[model samples]
Target: MAERPKNDHPIRSPDIALPFCFFCMMNEPDPVLRTLKITEYFKEMPTRDDRESVLALSGLWSIAMTRPNNPEFPEIGIFECMAKLICRGISDREWLLRDQNVYIPYYAAHIIGSYVMNRAEFAEIAVESGVIPPLMELLKGKISWVEQRVAVRALGHLASHEKTFESVAEIGGGVVELAMEISSIFVENVYRQFFCLKQRLKYQRNLLTRGLGGVEIENRKAEEWAIQTQCWSLHLLNCFARKERHLNLLCKRDFLKNLCQIWGGLMIPEAPGGIGLLKTLCKTEPGRKMVADLEQVLKSLCVLARSSDERQVMAIECLLSLIKDPETRHRVLEISVLSLVDLVELENGSELKKPKLGNTLTQALLQDYHKIKYGNQKLHSERAKRALEEIWELKVEKKRREKLMSEKEMKKRKLLVGILKKQGNHKFRNGEIEKAAMKYTEALNICIPKMRKQRLVLYSNRAQCFLLLRNPESAISDTTRALCLSKQGSPHSRSLWRRSQAYDMMGLAKESLMDCLLFACCRIKLKHNIPCYAARMISKQANATSVFGCVKVRTFEETKSLLENRQWGNMTIGGC
Candidate 1:
């Protein structure tokens, strides 16, 4: 509130001045404009001191452009510029800058990788720009790990697109050889680390014996780089192996043995990438032959099949592919693979355990084993045929037992329903109509529709309870169900009569008359004295008038009067 000390300057509010100052401080160049300017500077091929700055700027641009929501890079021609940079060979002047020549291609590869990481369109563009040949050359050359890594990653991104994938296979010759070379380097590095560690432990033991503290054995930096290189090389090989020709080339170089050695020796922790490459190679006939030629490949695969890891699934798949070839199948049989298959088939105490193991085995090896074993009639036809017949008989017996058990269970349920129905009848006679209805409902709940006689009786009994409870609608519903259930003899006639009574109570005169006529016709067809017997039953019931009123013939006099008046002319009693 006090006057500000502003001498010659105009008095300014602190709030306004603070915001203005903040705005001035926060002013920065737009990232897109800066990226364009940097890209232009890089294209000028600046001096040696400016080269590192250009690479740093381009690296930042590459990272920023990799974001999904960022604007399209090709709009500014940056993608084309980067592609041209990658495709251009290293100039003699550039090669003179010690290791600076490597950085140029590395940064270009990095920018290309960022562009095509998740974008298939950009990948196709990269392939069409002819960047893959340089990248493959980088992989083939003796280069720094940083340059090789970047090149391999770029090729991998480009290979994800189908168009680019075909180009990689066609243009990128020696890619398999490169991968195998890297794999050998990785294996050698791993063995060196192992021997080094063994020696270090022994030295540490001697030092401890001499009362000096043991030394910490640090892992070599080269081993870490080798592992990363191994993974990327394997990924690239797997990509190329999608084509059969590349796969065949890979197989010719003892590739299966190398992969088996790594996987079986536990050289790398979970080499699923290598295993995946092996699986791709094994898909071809020549590849399978190469795998079969390896000394311990099949044995290692059999051991791997017993593991529970996802890698084991890939191993099993490779084994299955190998067993499809007749030569390889005979080789597998000679190796006594049946012993390994037998482990899965052994009858464990738990029924579920055996089948689950058997399913994995059958899906992978045993199914193919049986196919190969039985298809050759000249080798062991009689023995194979006998085994097949025994298996078939066992399957049939298993099915028969299942069917008999089902029938037994069904009979037991029906027996339970019968007992419930007897209890319901006892309750009904005791005049507990609601309790009797409840019991009948319980019986109906468990009663199967296939038991027509039982279901019909349950419906009829429940309908009687509904009538006693004065629920004529529900009574009609139950009786209708009973009639539909069994349409023969006494049951049908009884259901019809019960429904007629329900209709009469509901004051449905026409429907009641129709049902009564149908019931009388049914009784007449049975050669029973229909009208006399019906009248006797009606007389025994006090509420018979409501049931017979629709016919207008409750008494003999009424019947005679109807006959004389010809009121029955339109109704046919026997033709229901």
Candidate 2:
């Protein structure tokens, strides 16, 4: 056969998706359109080359769409399946994953990590399938180190999951080793942004109530979780430690010292972090008594130059995340502060109204500062200056509202959002339709812009809110909008399922069942959920009207029996 002419635009650019993007999945309530688009992607993309990338990116769009504000989980399941098929095909093809051709697997890993970060259903699938182990197999051989880095990254993601943590541990997983080998290539500072935000938000509430500022008990539950998560992470460091043995050369000692100190700080809280020798002394106190006894160990930071100390960076970060908690930080400062210059000094200055007692780190700072000034040990002079600048900046901001908003206002926002959500949920719980609508609308008035998802959900709740509020037209419009942007807006059984409910609300029975079959089959495929579909249609098919409207399907005994046999929750399905 003659060679086919190659179009100049061989690989499709990322912009191809901009034209037909269905982020309308957020507000899309149409079951047929959603499913058809997905089918079109799989069926109509001209080349095998572009199809997978397009499919993978489409999956990325759904990540935010499926969050709690919108519970269209089934759409996520659908796109994840699509993403997997594309990635699986790439993994199966060896030539496709090589050097000049590495973008394939690189993008694959990017997709895997994106989904992994989102904690998509695919995460559970990735763990159960030992796919992480097999993907780690790519770490060897002559493929691009960048591709290898991606494989290691996926492992890092798996390593983060609590369920997969021990399972990976049982095998001395290769992910750590691979990551250690290539730590130089990856930057992880922003990866923990969301986790950090949630922690700060929790503490911000505490500051409001006590009229006390600063993260109290920062070492407790919040920091504890970060610490406990580290055993697996620290062990992954063995991967880096085993290679390029001189981590000390490139990476800073304070950096590595901070790493060990985080875990060590957790073990012995009477120490300061960011600079705590006493905490290190006590935690490593088997035969060592004085701080000098562990100088060799403290020197581990200098040795991290080879494997590129990311594990160390992450470990220390896990600890720093908790320093906002007072009890944990207090204990940490007492035992481990290397000098009198604790982070508090950098944060609050020496002359705050009432100064804190923990300052051993101040002393250590003096000593280390002297040693580096005198050239006793190797140092990243520029990094040290930057660290000092940070300290000076902290001193200025210590007593200031770190998060800016006043305690009362922050509390009001948090309180109002949480309470409003609960009230609306409660109204629905009690089957008080009118009350729920009022509650959600009231909440809507108080909501702010950054809380866009909540706004989206508030609008959704309002649709249901309106239904109970007895405003069907507004209800239909709100729900229709919510479904469009929701994850289920994609072609999947779930969008169909939600649409079924919406059409039923609008009194459009036939239109409701049109995709009802698709949704029903989807549920049945999952085994036990089969009854939901049948229940939706139970005894309702007898109507002769082809028109779409909420036609009450007669079900006196049919529903009564459904109530009796399915271990009924005493919940009545009214006007079926």
Candidate 3:
């Protein structure tokens, strides 16, 4: 099991438990104990062993120095103390010292001040000693006001260092996710910290690195300084990311996910690196490994392609560059052909997401199709249309396969229902839920009396379709039939849980509660199982009335509270 990051320390040794080290309990009035009286404990370090003891002493002293305004130990950077530990013939506990929060003050100092004193060596040492990850964590952390100011200041200086660039480049593609998530937090506030961190970063380093990009700057200039500083910050960010994954890790196909998330402000407009760098990263081996799915990457790339702005043009240029490769270009042509047909059938302006590059890509391919089908090869290509089958395969058909496979003994005679199930599934995953329901109903209509298991699955599938279409009565009736036909150990138990969810969704709480209890008691014996737990937790009811007009029981916040405390099974009379 992974160790939690909680600040609990190991048991202490008896020797170090004396007056000096155990300063909180000391009464001998020694000088070391006198200084340590401030901090409550030395974080319980084990120093009985000779080697670990020296490290423990170092860690204790380091922890004591955490507070900057303590007015005892002067502000010395961690690199200085690092040299002290190495030179003191002290045991190897550099990691222990780095792990302590006391060095946070020193870490913040290094980020801001290292460049000021031409301290490239110090920066290199930290980078080599595996300190960059934690430092980057500090940069993106929910730090105190002073800590934030210090961290940004330090990162600004370090950004200009050649060593900084090399280390960041080598931070590996594996760290892409953590980097993206943490860096994304600063997209808004970074504008505020940019200037302070930038000029305060390394001027000499920037001087050497800032090559001819047809952009010139007078560092000492006062007007619109924020703009200049932001450019530099974006540059440093892009420079770091240019090597890692792309402009931001957000654009990586495997890196990001299509989970439930708020749509707005997801784009980092301040960093124009997304379409440009990543369009290249996708073709590279490192970039390829970083992405789990190439097709998914292409779809994500489509989001950027939808941009009408100048960078979108650049992004198109990048895409066009990729198309020059026969395989990649062939893939784009195929995917876009089907995607175009999918879009035109829908209402105009259905897409609000700007990064919907797929739309423009469709247009581009349709025009190309006109050029080829009429002017060149006359290719009314079914293969291109077949690419939609993959999208349908991955996203849409998941439900159908899941539903059909739920049975232990499904009848071979009812195989046509599986086909319609796939059609219904594709329709639903493609955001055509009503059509999907129609498909499911047609499938259910075809299920023979001989195929009871198939009928149960079709009814259950249709109930889901009803819920998705917001038709509560039809959904409830279908689910009722499904529950009755489904055997105790049949695959229909899943249908039981889904019925409860559908009932919960329809605000028919009496029906919801009945199925919820049935699932909780019969199907899932455990409280924390996903379906039962979520049915009871996520579904809401009126403050004072259930669907049957009885007293409303648990609220959303109460459920959330139980979830936070891991006390979900604590449901009881009057305490819900």
Candidate 4:
């Protein structure tokens, strides 16, 4: 056709090797075929280069598996292959590191971790294929920090599954012991750095006082790594301690002491997760009894309750769990009432509202003072009564403020409705029927149900616009509502007359006749001082004449038979 493209030329340079086709091979559309090809590629690997390629492919597969509707890696032999790779990586550790290929084992464990994340069955497979032991070894700082974090995270994932939790717990030398060791090391490092920083600051301040400026604190990277390690360890322990036996074992360790140290604002960021662990521990009787003895634990929790952070909710929950036991309740009450008042003060209009905290605290105080005994029982009772009264008064005041605000809002809406109605009337007078209807609709929206008279008038006014716009069905609907809202002799006869006209336009002859009959009766009762029975009789005669004049001959004949038996008045044709 035209000159052939360069890529189509048969003679190409041979020196430029073809671009690596790794993704093309992995993206084979059929899952089974793709898995088979990948497996064969793994088997053909006989060199370090081939192993590196396989490791890269493993990372890709791990990412692909996370997407919805992606083909799954073959479960039959994949875990075993990954496990073998991990084992090989452990043996080849020094060479891999020397070659800067630490990512080999990291990606291997990452692939295994991704597999076990949401599926319990695969977790069991990972455990059975001897993946846990290497992961545990990796946590001992034998590898890069990145690799260690990955291994810990993998263990955390595996430990979360019910089927593999016990196995992970066992292979890791017990979750409680492992987590305690890691947390202890982490806490120690944190405090050491903190105290060192404090002393350095003091020295710097002394220098400044002696005519030298202070030096800035150097940020340590290890501290960040320590936090991550501790967080992952806590996550693993939390998963394991869901069972009663593991929880009891955790309580036996000095877990509460370490947690209280963190809880006492040593590191404020860790309190949320620490309190969460406390909540879990208190689920059991022995755990509760142990936590009850830690006075620092109770005081720290009370302090946390007043914080405006999201952690406040968790703190309150943990406090309630502790106070369920009699001894713990007494211990909580021993904390000064002044400190507990924040826990009892209700937060109004707070995004993080916790109404239950105030109620629970009041109940605890009352129970401690009135239901249980102390040395100053009467004084405690009187204090408790006074606190209860204060709480009640606060609640009442909040309700009063809310009620006043609501009334103010209603008055504002009513004022807006009045303005919108006037705008609508001006539009209607100018023959802007659609604009008038829109304004009327806006007015109706702001009109409260208590403003029945205003709503009735708006509906009737909009019905007239609907009639001019040739929407007789809507007109009839609005007028019917207006009539229902009006009393018998009210000035709503115009609404009835308009509805009759709308019915006639819609070819509803029988409905039109009935509305006309009611309208005539209402008009006669209001205009003429006649007895109710006489007014109704004259109105029926007028209804017959009006129907005959408006409807077709066929409809009039059908209606005439229904009204022919009633007595007729000696009225002229124009009198009706």
Q: Which model scores highest in TM-score?
A: 4
**Least well predicted 10-residue stretch by lDDT in candidate 3:** 258-267
Q: Of the candidates shown, which would achieve the greatest lDDT relative to the real structure? A: 4
Q: Which regions in candidate 2 have their CA more than 4 angstroms from the true location?
A: 1-29, 32-102, 118-122, 129-131, 138-142, 184-357, 360-576
lDDT of 2 by residue, 1-576 (tens): 222222112133234443233344434578777666655543432234432343344344345335422334333343344345434534555434322222344444544654554464556665654456444554441233334444554555555565655554555534444433333212221112112222232211221222233444432333333332232233334323323232432134333433433322232221222222222322332212222233433333212111111232222322332223333433322322221222222222224653332132333333344444466643444545444443334333332443565667756875798798888889788988778778887876665433545655776776765655556546544544343333321323443445455556666554455546655666676674666555646336314221111123324454344334532113121100
lDDT of 1: 0.55
Rank the candidate models, highest TM-score first: 4, 1, 2, 3
> Which has the higher TM-score value, candidate number 1 or candidate number 3?
1
Candidate 3 TM-score, C-alpha based: 0.31
Per-model RMSD to reference: 34.2, 28.9, 22.3, 31.8
Candidate 2, position 534, lDDT: 54
lDDT of 2: 0.40
| Per-residue lDDT of candidate 4, residues 134-241 (tens digit) | 776666644433455567767878878878888876764454575667655653433332223323222112211222333332223234445665666666766765
Q: Write the per-residue lDDT of candidate 1 for residues 1-576, one digit (tens) a residue.
A: 232322111111233222222122224367666555545544543233322333343443445456732445534444555555544433333342322233455566667777777677777766766677667766664333345666776776677567677777776456667767766554343333222332322211221222233333223333344456666667667777666656556876456666753422122322344677778778777777888777477766754443323365567667767766667765654442432333232222123444443344444443444455467433343543443343333234433654556777779879999999999999999999999999999997766546768978898899999999999867766675576455423437776677767776876543455566667778778888677645544443323332112122224444334334542223221121
Q: Which TM-score value belongs to model 2?
A: 0.33
Error in Å for residue 536 of model 3: 37
lDDT of 1 at 93: 30
> Candidate 1 vs candidate 2: which has greater TM-score?
1
Candidate 4: stretches off by over 4 Å: 1-24, 29-31, 42-51, 54-58, 61-71, 74-76, 187-226, 252-254, 260-272, 336-338, 347-355, 372-576
